[model samples]
Target chain A: MTYERPPTPGYDLGMSSSPIRKEVDGALLAFVARQRPNLLAISDELAPLMAALDALLAEGKRLRPAFCYWGWRAAGAVEEDLDGPPGERLHEGIVNAAASLELLQASALIHDDVMDSSDTRRGQPSMHRRFEALHRAQGWPGPARAFGEGTAILLGDLCLAWSGEMFETCGLDEERRRRGRAVYDLMRTEVMCGQYLDMLEGTRGEAAVDTALRVVEFKSAKYTIERPLHLGAALAGGAPEVSAALTGYGVPLGIAFQLRDDVLGVFGDPAETGKPAGDDLREGKRTVLVALTLERATPAQAAALQRRLGDPGLDRPGVDELRQIITDTGGLAACEAMIARYTGDAERVLAAAPVPEEARAALNALAVAATARRT
Target chain B: MTYERPPTPGYDLGMSSSPIRKEVDGALLAFVARQRPNLLAISDELAPLMAALDALLAEGKRLRPAFCYWGWRAAGAVEEDLDGPPGERLHEGIVNAAASLELLQASALIHDDVMDSSDTRRGQPSMHRRFEALHRAQGWPGPARAFGEGTAILLGDLCLAWSGEMFETCGLDEERRRRGRAVYDLMRTEVMCGQYLDMLEGTRGEAAVDTALRVVEFKSAKYTIERPLHLGAALAGGAPEVSAALTGYGVPLGIAFQLRDDVLGVFGDPAETGKPAGDDLREGKRTVLVALTLERATPAQAAALQRRLGDPGLDRPGVDELRQIITDTGGLAACEAMIARYTGDAERVLAAAPVPEEARAALNALAVAATARRT
Candidate 1:
């Protein structure tokens, strides 16, 4: 039974509640609601964890799930011999798989927030921050830091454990299940390795930029976009050639996504992004953009940049000065150009991929939309 | 085809390095060694994590794996029908499943140590403790605590992800594989839920002794014994009746095992247990023994005990006093009696189980040894 992406509804991006979008949303919502009872079953003893999961699940735009459905639909359309009702089972599997991705993402974000000491996420207090506030309100002894961190760590572990349960109950075929497991495993490993590289680079200083970027590619790009998309395509019975083509498209798009994210880290609005402006600066994140800036800057500029980077107490003026320095050193333009180059590469790959022309066009549009997302 | 445990060669428990035990050790060591090259294939970015995992895996006793193998053998002995060469395949599955259990335990411990602020485990520094020390040595800020918690969280996630991968690759029947997956899911959920209960009880500080005992049963017994044994038996095609029988035998044994652990926490020799003497006293862990003491103490003694509970800087004299009070109040004897009662109950359950006589006897002996071991 083949599937194809339903035709794009004639609507602008400003219309957040498009029917086509809602169709996918409705599917995911139905899946989540049905699974809600199961989640609640597990939630009985893990009420705080359940609340944290609810918050994390609420944050995503469901883009990965959408990609998975689209991939399945595109594959289904190519199977000429199958003429039957719309493949609801396939759609359900894709939705469940996609939801698992979101859960996995939540697990990572919870831990990442704790690791970065991030106070807010998706416009609300981060899990650790909320926990810290509770600790203070209860007047716990010693320090709020330990209690906050301990709760967040448990919450993250809870999410990881629940994600595994979700995957186990996904109800896919044996072969597909194994394939999905492999994809999920690789995704997890990449994110963790990427996180490790991110920490190591910050501690080891300027000597590790190249190593850090490679980590970014595997950790951020491969996990976030490349593998997930490939997993979807692979589940749709895409052959080796099709998977290779998707990888070609996915890698550059993934890189472009992270590159844009880096740009936002330095310059995005805090209100929209939901993180403090220059929060990355405060955390001293050693992104490729930052690495490039350091490499290209004059000694004085580099020293000035270094002074402001990772200073958690840095005020508005410090952030402004650092932003100005990055721009003056050509880091902003260089990053933007890199983003454009990668996006173009992704577009080129998509155009050359041997899928249906309509599917290719839809994927190209998704790549553009993803890379250009404002926040 | 039936499987049975190899006859126990009368080897000294303390110092004997018998060939049979060595063979089991060799199997595990060789499997891990062969996988070392594949471990290298894990990205260079995760080198430190891989190193940590290598060290952690080396420290485990392979106890669960041994039980799994025995469970398989015990079940095989009664099997009247077979589909394949049951010996090698069943043994391999048991070993892999067993290894996966150890990995899961390792993952849980890494996170648990961080949550409990525990500094030592298995005679060595906890993973988080090591990371925290590193953070401090590098002159990181006052809150090196987050780094420690974050690293441990990631390490646990990595272990869980890898454990799933290992299980997925285990060559087994599809139905049996699904059953195994279900067992794993339940085990993870139970542990997390149990952990939440533990934290909640500690925070509330009003948990009844019964409530504390329930937490121990769910958190330790169900997870450590019942589930692991049942998983192995199910993998070997043991009927539902067999699983029920195993659970009946496992539950009380597991509780007895934990009671012994609680006793060791307060009075174990520091050198043998690889922890400071009275470490649990310092941490104010509200074990069943402590609960018993609180119930039986005089009003003045109870007040004094409550004041010292959870005191981070609890002194040696305080530890000594609490120990004396428990003994003076007869709580120590009561606790010991409870342990003995559970051990006796475990023996009754084993006697009533429907397994082969010899296999049942062997399991009973192991249970007694496990719960009664002094360190």
Candidate 2:
């Protein structure tokens, strides 16, 4: 398996992330190292999975944790105001708490790639593909594909378990953890349900715009943003109102962020996106953009779009035709307009939010970087 | 799509199970039903997954929880002595905590089936096959196998999550849940790492007895028996010595239990075993039995054994031949001897255990049931 990969995402975020990155990476690295001996103590044969996880962790966007951290600040936590060892402990604790999300994200990405049958992730061979290659190279008995997928599934399960373990043991107080765990539980269930529904949507070529939008809502809006924000607020011992306000801002911004990703999946440069152009179209994902295009296309155009959308063998010409059809049908315009609208909705929520002044500014900047990221 | 299944596998416990089964099943059903509306709220497309999970839960042996419950009792919990409301709460809470193991077991079984590429489970289509059939029935647009595996992965993930969730929310006090969580987390990592190592064993036709036994120690001995017992002890606020004592009893009993399963996999009646006869041979599991057989076999017999071990097309004659060779080379006898030795070791531990009188009786019966079961 080639270990080569593009620069990890988040370097391009329009923020000074060097310190935050170090702390998050430290927490992630430490927690992962702690779990390693448990697996390796059983057999050194399990080392490959640890390596794969480390690589995936390195490439994570760290966006959810970023939102979670700012949500902590939004709940009236000014890091500079609290000075002492306990305060430092709180800082380290929250960083570790936020870092748990990265572990969860890595888990989702591994399993999601298998579900999508995508061979690569973030410019590297995907987790299952890596296992598949290892199996073939080792001349292992049985079907290499099954071995690959099976190991990937197991590794993903480990990450998911680790995510929760890290969150619970992040040195947070009992009360804070109790509150945060509710949000954590809800977030996990939402993603599981959303992913299953979204997979179903891929099979339904004629799925409606509402259906596609709901998948985005469950998979992206809540999972990517709302729940993370709520977790941070809860961990900070914020009252119900703080969680409610954050949700208002997080949901729409998350929708816009996902829309941006959908756009990049179709149109962005491979270097910028770390995925090949039109990857979503190849996966036959019934995104809101595709639903809009199907709604507006002529009968013949719609039929052609459906035929080519999920064809794994679709060539450059087919992608170009689909892109052109999507543009001519005004689906691209509608999607862009919706992103603008959702971003505006999020901005309105931020304007009236009870966030502390510095946190308000940080959240505003994050919304921009989130919805407008090129990668 | 077909929901017919074998009678759930706990009826022949060689003890009265009527009341215990009701409480455990009630806890499991309630917890699962509680989580269902959240998924259905996203879309009813998730209902099939729910149904699949329900069917799986129905068929689980519930043996882990039984071990755990007695572990609690072994630590001085007496149901009859606690007669008040608080006592009732403790009873219900422990039951719920015990029930969580079934969910975790369900998760492992689903993914294990996918990994093993097994078709039927408990006289019905395996979880992945159920989804594959659903895809074919619905004429879904993708590889049915991929879709099936993907959905099963997600559903299994849900069960894993729910298992932890149930444990945390089992209405036990903070001290109990906190201690229990550590065991739960360790149990998860052990099974994951162990399962991966065991899967690798399937590929290595020449894996030795020590290697195979190590897999059993991690995958079965610890995961199936020791950890669950530890979780119960910890939750009961047992002291360190109590935990250590239980471990002495648990580990060897668990090894014997797994060896029994290995024997049944090769020799038991399909109806009683809930698996096809000689199934382990077809799967090419490098069990201690196989390893021991190789250790004793002549060069020609070993080569013949390797050639036919993992061929999926092995018919009755091929299975019979392999069985004959295993017996000739003393593999089966060696395995039986090992099982008897482990069981004896466990019985000695129990005899010296500081268990309550009634719990001592129950624990002995469970050990017998576990290692001597036909199914």
Candidate 3:
């Protein structure tokens, strides 16, 4: 069921090759491997924890870290020139910051999968599902739900704790370290607040759609793109204006990324998305697409959708009908248009920013890839 | 139904004159009150979340933070020390660390409640129970259990994340910050390991008695007493040997503290403990007392005990029979004796530590008070 990614396009004409991405990934993998012994000593009973973490970590594309490294590079950092020594310390700092973003992403996913009650992620069984199976096999008390959640909660907390530990121990300059703290704090808080908004929208109905979108911007957009890029820029000792400019581009790009995800949630094939089609509809997820569909649906269609929404027993026909209604109402097209608008806006911002022309071209390519991702 | 605490002799020693505990408590409460606005801004949907966290935080005795502060004081930190100002900043550092401990404790409790599946904590409904109520009230889809767990897991993750933010943001000396990181990491890893061992013991049966004891030491002892005290001492720039000396005393005291809690889990009245009597027995918690009971019980008695060990449907008569078996086999007395031994050993360690005589007296008194608490 794994969908192979398309080959990456060539770098922009003006930009030269940099070993930043591979360097960051290598350092992070080595650091994590070094901590493995200590982690093993901590949980011999839960030996699978390490393996699970490794697998989850490996699934990520090092996009965030690349932004972090490029942020530094754009801030006038260069690798060892033929006549100069290597900037080992600066490179280390960039790698550390990059590694943190990946860790935070991993933490979010572990908790998110449990919150969404997802059965599969990245073409594999979800962590909660794996733990739930173990709970059932062992005949644990109360129900499998308790054990599944207990493990997920602990696992997420462990990731957060370790992420902080990594940030603290990453030998970065004092100024950059202080700057990084502000970004990290904002990112974590935003995610939590966004989660609260999402939950509220689900329960309170459509009265809060605007608020829900704001939550999406602050929570998912800021955390996923804007902040990661901002954090990397801050770590590279970028000027305040540079961070602001990056955010201008990153925010819209982040929105487009999530908007695309919402579309995929319903229309995406099960094999490619690693989720059953119309899963969000069955879960009653209050996404913008759902909101638009509700606003546009006929009275009869709206009533039928409402009846099926949040229904755990929703079957194939119900899913098909809901999808058809959404499509017929033009909600899908509107969502697609919104994604395109945001992507265009991000590219415009990038064009106006004072970044290197070559970097801008690469960044524009990244924006297109992110927004146009099919699965 | 309230069980009266025994009036221990010399319980009021220095209580009438001591202003240190009162000062620290005031500082902590004031800081928390000021931060209310910040917390409120982070969540509009999760109303229950803030309320539950507030209640849980309110219930903490601040015993760990108290130990930390005292450790600092014992290491020659004077109220008027010319080096650091006395008013807000220094106090905020200590309060932040204290608050971090409280938040960490909350994170552990949320996960533990899910793991244990008990209905109540601190004379109030547990977080999972609160979430379950919300699920039922809203008529949410799927089992209420899943919703309850999903909310609790997210809530706990938020607490862990917030705790790190607070710790990182707290203004403290670099040396002290480094020390704090070490203690925090150890504290987190130990608790998880301890939890793993605890879970394993329940499944492995009587053969894990020694392993269970080791779990108690790592999970409760090091975390509850040793680390907090060390963290506080280290913050005040206490010599490594000084904190080491406190550890010498804290470890045994922490073990005794857990031993007493284990005793209360079975024999203590529900009114005093705020949990149903023999709740641990019903849950089949594999405590030292349970291990002892199994070692001493006759084969027929052991069979009967095993039948009711994890029986959620065990009636009052069944619980009574289990209690009788524990008492008749002298397991209760043996447990009490063990508590006494550990407490006595803790006292000896306190006497042997290189602390000032006055500090030693205070620590000894605190140890006695901790071991003798009714709730």
Candidate 4:
């Protein structure tokens, strides 16, 4: 329905990503291309759904796939086989499995937006909003919002089903796949549970740092990096020690990555982040940074922070004030200190990790980029 | 959380069900028992979700699993394997696969309730309703309805994810499992697409008979019976001819099954059906019965029907009037005739099918029960 644009790679991380990005993109494109006719055969009206998914997919950076690829290489999977025919057979299967994660991510984001009543994603109208606009454009009967939310839910279900189908059909040998399958299963369940936990947190008046950190561990840290890496290593038939080492390297780095995201949620440029400034605060997310601020605030500052933290109508002045309070209370510095400590721990683990040479360099670069990204 | 009740076996058709029911229930109970502690490990607050799922699951009649078990048997899988050690291993795998279908059904029902904004399911508050009540009971902040819907969505996703995991880990040998996996994959996609089509139809003014039939074929016939039969047959490594025969018997029987449901929705006793009498009329479902009435109705009658079809406040008097219109238009008679014809067709196919003797008997009984049930 709109002008077709080729998918752009996700956040640059200031690194060359052509090789990994191409394979992941190729896998996803091929999968969707194959499903296109089947979906259209179901109904022409369904075409918009495919278009919506394609647009959303095009904006991904293949972050999970990249993590997966490097993890596989770290566990003795050869980099030389990444492009050649002999390597293509094994590499393609893993790539497809990696790409499946993107679909899973798409499913989660679509559903999450509906849950949050988010208006936009990736600088575009969120899925339900897009569908709502369609309903209004068509002058359809009944509530447009209900229709939009219903279709969005169904679309997300389709994506979730497709993600499973993709992974199961990824052509990996069953033995190697077993372990990865376990990780994949745990990752999916954990993410949903974590989301529930986060929702539960929103219902409460105050946030404990431990509760905030627990949410981080389940919702972001494990899902974003640890599980993907384990999934890749499992696919490569990594030994117990190799898997353990990847976990060791992954956890601290993933936590640091989330901390960086929390920091960026408040401080990053809207242009780079593709979100409104103070979007997290507007949404009333109980991030660890917010928890720390609550812990350290003076009485007046605490009262003000509590009053304004979840106020949906808070303006730029309010955000500036909150920022000043966080700074004055040392919440920002303490959070920065936590990020540095985790980054150091990750680097130390990577240094002693039983990984190949090239993989080590790539992983270190990724850790730096993950912890230090502005977007 | 409440007193546990043993799961009731699905519609009996006057046949003994203890053998099949025990195995299916055992598999489901064992699976849940295993996951309970792991879920609690994630967070104690998550207890209510598991409790809710357990309560929902406890009420199922295991219809899909029964169809699957019978299908497996028709394909020459041994009845003796239902009990003996060797038989237990193989039977247990199939049972788990069948149990997975129940979870899939649960997921669908949960989300479907949200979409339709239905208040009750299985004579109890639907998942969203339950969650809404929970929020109100706890005096939780924010919109209770939104919170309820969000949690229900996530819970549905969790069930969907668990269904896949259970299916993959059913422990069938890989080669046979591959064939079943393909069917499983197709079944999931088809059902979701069918649901979308059903929802889309609801947004339109009048449903055509042909369109209504298409919905029946996709949304119920294949998903409710044909696919489950095929899935079981596939797992048993049935020859193509056997699978085709099962489909022949299954398609008509499944369609008949849905027709029975539609009829019962209008005329059956509420106590027996577990729904209010004339619930379908109140919801304005675009069933074949409604389509036929539209085709045959006088202009005045059509106008009246259209005006009241989807009115949420339609009371018993309104239901009776609509019933009278349908009867006068011969919609009810035509629907009954169609059901009888399809049931006859199904019986003929089953009689001539090359299935094992005992299995054929069980299938015929199921068809009779499916088409003739008061519930």
Candidate 2, after superposition: displacement of residue B30 in Å?
A: 1.2
For model 2, the superposed segments whose C-alpha errors exceed 4 Å read: A1-18, A80-88, B1-18, B80-88
Best model per lDDT: 2
For model 1 the TM-score comes to 0.88
* CAPRI class of candidate 4: medium
- The per-model DockQ list reads 0.41, 0.63, 0.36, 0.60
Backbone clash pairs for candidate 4 read: A10-A61, B81-B87
Put down candidate 1 lDDT per residue, B255-371, tens digits, no spaces. Answer: 877888788888877777777777887777778888988889999888888888777787788878878887888778888998898888878877887677756755765675566
Over B1-375, each residue of candidate 2 has an lDDT whose tens digit, in order, gives 111121333344433543666688999999988888987887887888888888878875678887788788788777863442463467788889999999899889888988888887877899999999999999966678877888888988888888888888887777788899999999999999999888887765556988888899999999998998898888888878878888999999989998888888888788976778899888888888888889999998899899998789989999999999989999899999999999999999998988887777777777777877778
**What digit string (tens of lDDT, one per residue) describes model 1 on residues A1-375?**
112222331112212432335544454455446545654564464555566656666666556655654565455434332232453355455656666766677778878888888888888898888777876887755356666766777677766766666666665566776776767776777777667666656665542456656767877778877787777776667777777877788888888888878878889888667788988888888888888788789999999988878898988899899898889999888888888998899888878877877567667667766677666
Expressed as tens digits, the lDDT of each residue in B268-287 for candidate 3 is 77776778888888878888
- By TM-score, rank the candidates, best first: 2, 4, 3, 1
Better of 1 and 4 by TM-score: 4
Residue-by-residue lDDT tens digits, candidate 2, A258-302: 888888878777886778778888888788888888889999999
Q: Rate the local accuracy (lDDT) of all candidates.
A: 0.70, 0.83, 0.72, 0.82
Give per-residue lDDT, candidate 1, residue B78. Answer: 39
RMSD per candidate (Å) reads 4.5, 4.7, 4.7, 4.7
Ranking of models by lDDT: 2, 4, 3, 1
Superposed Cα deviation of residue B227, candidate 4 (Å): 0.8
